[model samples]
Target: MSTVHIKPVPVTPEEVIAVARDHARVVIDAEAREAMAASRAIVDAIEREGRPVYGVSTGFGALANTFVEPERRAELQHALIRSHAAGVGDPMPEEVVRAMMLLRVRSLAMGRSGVRPEIAEGLAALLNADITPWVPRHGSLGASGDLAPLAHCAMVLLGEGWVREADGSRVDAGPVLERAGLRPITLSSKEGLALINGTDGMLGMLILAVADLRHLLTMADVCAALSNEAMLGSDRPFQPELHEIRPQPGQAKSAANIHKLLQDSEVMDSHRNDLAHAVQDAYSMRCAPQVAGAARDVLAYAETVADQELRSVVDNPVVLPDGRVESTGNFHGAPLGYAADFLGIAATDVGSISERRVDRLLDITRNRGLPAFLSPDPGVNSGLMIAQYTAAGIVAENRRLSAPASVDSVPTSGMQEDHVSMGWAAACKLRTIIDNLGTLLAVEMLAATQGLQLRLPLIPSPAARAATAAVGPIAGKPGPDQFLAPVIEQVKRLIESPALRHEIEEAAGPLA
Candidate 1:
């Protein structure tokens, strides 16, 4: 409930995520405003000298050498924003737009963008009011720091573009600013360019994706263990001694979680000495910890990149401590793009492995004694057969989504930016991959929980019972086919919630 203060230093990814997703209010710290004032003083001194500056006294991109009269500089900045407000496709989710605005303000607050402190203050106020700008989905090339999308955000600050109202309607921003007792920002010489020239958009998406994957990865372990138990397979692969030698931290953590979840299972004890069970389980069941743990490590690396980016000053011609304004390539988004793409591939693989588990749960030949498609009645009901189909289709889509978006780029701005990062594309596609992964995992959870249900009097491990109990309200018991989409959605929401983790941890202790 506390306001997220904008400090003079770099912000944390947690703070950015809070502001974006939680609607946490923000206010600029006085020290950051003072820093901006000092930085602005340096820019003011330069403007009076009449020497050409890349963004202050001259035009942008390929027109860097073109000069405008002192009287036309304000017009130049506004014109720049208008021309760059060229994004196409649907509006980005409100959370992404909010995060982008917050990051821009954070960069300006760092005293590097030569922006007036008021610019940051006005943005903070808009964010506090939840007045989200309409940033179209496609625009950023990732090299120029998501210019077009950020430009749309900057246009909203100037009351020139549309903003999403409290009722979720897109309306003119001028009246919204006024009704909220806020005034439109009047761009000074460099303020407009200052607002748009940063890697906020792609970085914002990367941060959100990391947050989502952390939870989903943990859930991946939960579902994997449930499948192993439901299929009547051995949990020996999750034994700590088996994984300690390899010592991949994520793998160890996942193995420990599975080891804990499989404890107290009467089913495993039911067939322990019976040679009827397969000597070894399929890779999906036995190698669950390996693949999911690798994904956990991938997310850790991506989180490191996200944290570094959060603290970086990602703008061109940054105002330095020594009163120099020098053009730099710090705005390039290659780092964020690479992180997004890597996480995408990892998430896709995690989903693929989970889909295989779902297939095993449904296949009569493979499910040991469970019914075909996990149906309560074989021929009378189709059961979750279609759910496995959904998982397979989603897994296929995720594989395509995992292709590296950062590996490709197109020149823009008349070749002034000859090599683009395409990181925004990478981050955006990563969002989709994570979402798809979430849904596919939901199917695994659904089918696996139903498989646990069919086990009946054969008691499940404490962790499996707890995890299934968390979704029991909607998932119910194994029965004739019901509408599966709503149940998948319900379980998806539950998987993303704290309740599942709380219950599972209560029984299995904290998951890694």
Candidate 2:
């Protein structure tokens, strides 16, 4: 297995995906261990002096002023983990749990968390062993660093929580660690607070969402171009000159991508100079780049936030190089929350526009000469009429989800941590938005390809041809529909996978 090393330098989105999604092994860097030891020495001094620091010698949150006896500090850390592992829902997917664990490990490895180097090494062992703790889905307020989710993860370190087996069944962590030739590490001093005190869950989802959206964004352009060709819409709107005056980076890129996809097409060329066919296309067909491009810009902005966050010291009472332990608002998660919410809003626009194109494809009045619903027998065979409905349904759901989660903050932790970021909720709903949009686009691909096949004599653009072939036999021939749900699922799999986008990019040079 390939190993991802945790260094003090800022990590990349790819690294997080590797450990989280790809199940790659993780190793803490040697320099990070040295730095952690130095930081631990400082924490040790504070403990020795009984200085009543926020997390080291004192109780947490509402109990911060209450002093913990020296011998009881370890018990304090243990109790903290047990109390905070209060997440309540079905377990989060293994990939998300893995990402959260990796992010927490990365934060601690930065040497500012005042944790023993062995603590980090222990977390690395769990990751390397794929001993993912079962983290419940709900209960994060996206402030104080995803406390509940990370605590469930931290519980596994003390052999207290459940870890998932190969088949996703839960088992005791103690036995799992023993089987992995490992022993659970006992938390000491500020270690427990350090483990759970960061925005790992929200940040992890944000990074994963960014990665997923990149693929879906490419698929959106491909489907839009397919819709344009299927509907016999003019490609003039996607010309570089039209986008240059406005010149939003994402808009220009989407325009260029659509241009490439619509280039060298028999369908486009047949009517390239025929003004008699139509004057202008609908907004869904003409403004494809504008919508998808805007989403791309939102995605880019989110990436900037995720990048900076990867390099951030998100733990509370972050230990500085000069041995100062200070309480800061670094763990608030507002920045990440807002970024995630913005992306959700942008993604809904992309899906909405795609939904409109799907509607145009099925409408006899709008779909040029294609039969109603693209059915061979318009009345007897409903054909892809219902696919548009599916797309519309998903679009409506996405609209509701696109409402910003960052602004809906509720007070948490007895109101001491008021105005919570709700970033976790933002991140969670964004996942669904990205997914539903993909399904919606899959429906578009289904109808667009069926529409393309109906325009049989005039071949689609080379890029559309490649993507259509990738969609398989269900989209290849236009006839009475058989099991529309499975067909949509089949194309949804194609959309979820890289095959469609890969084939399109391979045929067309590359999407932005």
Taken over the whole model, the C-alpha lDDT of each candidate is 0.90, 0.89
**lDDT per residue (tens digit) for residues 175-254 in model 1:** 98888898888899988889889999999999888999999999999999999999998988889999989989999999
For 175-245, candidate 2 gives per-residue lDDT tens digits of 88888898888989999999999999999999999999988998898889999999999998998999999
| RMSD to true structure for each model, in Å | 1.1, 1.2
Clash count (model 2, backbone only): 1
Indicate the residue-level lDDT of 454 in model 2: 85
lDDT of 1: 0.90
Off by over 4 Å in 1: none
- Alpha carbon lDDT of residue 379, candidate 2? 80
Q: Provide the TM-score for each candidate, comma-separated.
A: 0.98, 0.98
Report backbone clashes per prediction: 0, 1
